[model samples]
Target: MAKIAVVAANGKAAKKIITEAVNRGFEVTAFGRRAENDTDAKNYIQKDIFDLTREDLKGYDAVVDAFGAWTAETLPLHSKTTQHLADILSGTDVRLLVVGGAGSLYVNPEHTIQVADGENFPEAFKPLAQAMAAALSELRKRKDVKWTYISPAADFQAEGERSGKYILAGEEFTLNPAGESVISYADYAIAMVDEIESGKHIQERISVVGA
Candidate 1:
């Protein structure tokens, strides 16, 4: 069985991922700030994310980073927490799978512009977007760590339906057949668990949209 660790396991996305991985029979350990009474995973690690060390994560095949920060002060924690995990997992065999932001995905084929740079992007979300973008940027520089950044579509919905269907794409942003860029937290979880089992996009960033 694949031994997996999910950070910030109480979050909507992480909870869905935990449920999916557990239902698939993967040995999943959930890491969160507090113990979850209703967590799907049997194993749990209740501790501050930054306080976690490599020894705490030893023997896992992959670690899913579902950490999130939306405020001006907390937004920087996105990159900080990613760097912390990268440092701890450096030179290890464990794969670092990050729950990335779509804002950083390229808007054009030339890769010169990102979704966050677009005028249509919301001003309120730019700080969080830039922080996540920075995290992906710094993560790419670490050749020693095995990392895969997965960006969800522009209209990521927590309450959206889980058709268990999605289109996985490369760096450039993409839309589905209906001309929509959207995905549910449940569907995105399917992609994350699939990646964990397949390991097809190591050291690369991939995006997912509803199919």
Candidate 2:
């Protein structure tokens, strides 16, 4: 069984992931600040990721972070929590899959969609956005530990179905099969879990979208 740990597993999509993972017969562990609703599996655990020590990561084959800067207001906590996760993971042989912001994904050789010069990207949100970018930057240089930073389309929100199909790529690449870009949170999770199981992508940043 694939032993996986999902940090901040109380989020909407995360609940689906845990459900699907358990149904698919994988050993799933979810750690978060608050208790999740319920699960058939006894893998749910309550703990602040920031409180996790290096030993905390010993058992999982992969760590999926659905945790994002909640409100633009929580970037400080976001940065701190994220950095702590990255730091702890960096010390181990485990894989890291933290979601990045679309703002940093490049639209052209000279510019990125997240922040354009003189353009506003959520100011309060930028800190964690920046944190994701910085984290990906550091992860890119590591030869050990598989890394995959994912971003949703511009239309990403709490909607869609678990169709189990989407796109994947690294920096400077965009996966938009519809001519325009968009993906359901469900489809994104399907792709997310698929990657966790397949181990096809290692040390890359990709965006998820539908056709």
Candidate 3:
């Protein structure tokens, strides 16, 4: 079984990922500032993201970075934490899977502009989105680290049923038949663990949309 460590495990997305991974029989360790009130994983570690050392992450097969920040002031933590992980996992076999935002996804075929740069993008969420974009950029430059950044659909729903169905795409934004860019957190978690097991999109940015 793959030994997986999920950072920021208390978050909604992380919780779903943890549940899905546990259900799939993967050995999971939950890492966060506090223990999850309800978690299936038997192992739990409470520590600040930056405080995690290479030794602390040594044996994990893969690390799922589910860390997120909502405010502009704390947005820089996204890139900072990503860089720290990259540095620590540089020569190790441990793969890093980042739960990214949709902001960096391309808005057009040319891929000249990102969804975060589009006019309709919400202003309030721009800082957080930009932070995730920066994290992706940082990951892309880490040649020594195995990393995969998975961006969710444009409309990422926090509450929805897990359909066990989704469409995986490259850097460009993906839309469903009805022209909607959306995916529930539950399904997104399923997609994430699937990618972790497959290792199909390593060292790249991929997106998940509703099927």
Best TM-score among the predictions, by candidate number? 1
Please give the distance, in angstroms, between residue 108's alpha carbon in candidate 3 and its true position after superposition. Answer: 2.1
TM-score list, all predictions: 0.98, 0.82, 0.97
Give stretches of model 3 more than 4 Å off: 35-37
lDDT of all predictions, in order shown? 0.94, 0.70, 0.91
1-211: candidate 1 lDDT, tens digit per residue: 9999999889889999999999999999999998553579999989888999999889999999999988788988998999899899999999999999999999888999999999989999888899999999999999999999999999999999989899999999999999999999999999999999999998999999999
Clashes (candidate 3): 0
Model 3 C-alpha RMSD to native: 1.1
- How are the candidates ranked when ordered by TM-score, highest leading? 1, 3, 2
Model 2 lDDT tens row, 38-113: 5444677789887887788887888887776656566555556656777787857688887666656776675454
Candidates 2 and 3: which is better by TM-score?
A: 3
Clashing pairs in 2: 103-114
**lDDT of the structure predicted as candidate 3:** 0.91
> Which residue pairs come into collision in candidate 3?
none
Error of 2 at 199 (Å): 1.8
- Name the candidate that leads on lDDT: 1
Q: Give the 10-residue window scoring lowest on summed lDDT in candidate 2.
A: 111-120
Q: How do all the candidates rank in terms of lDDT, highest first? A: 1, 3, 2
Error of 3 at 23 (Å): 0.4
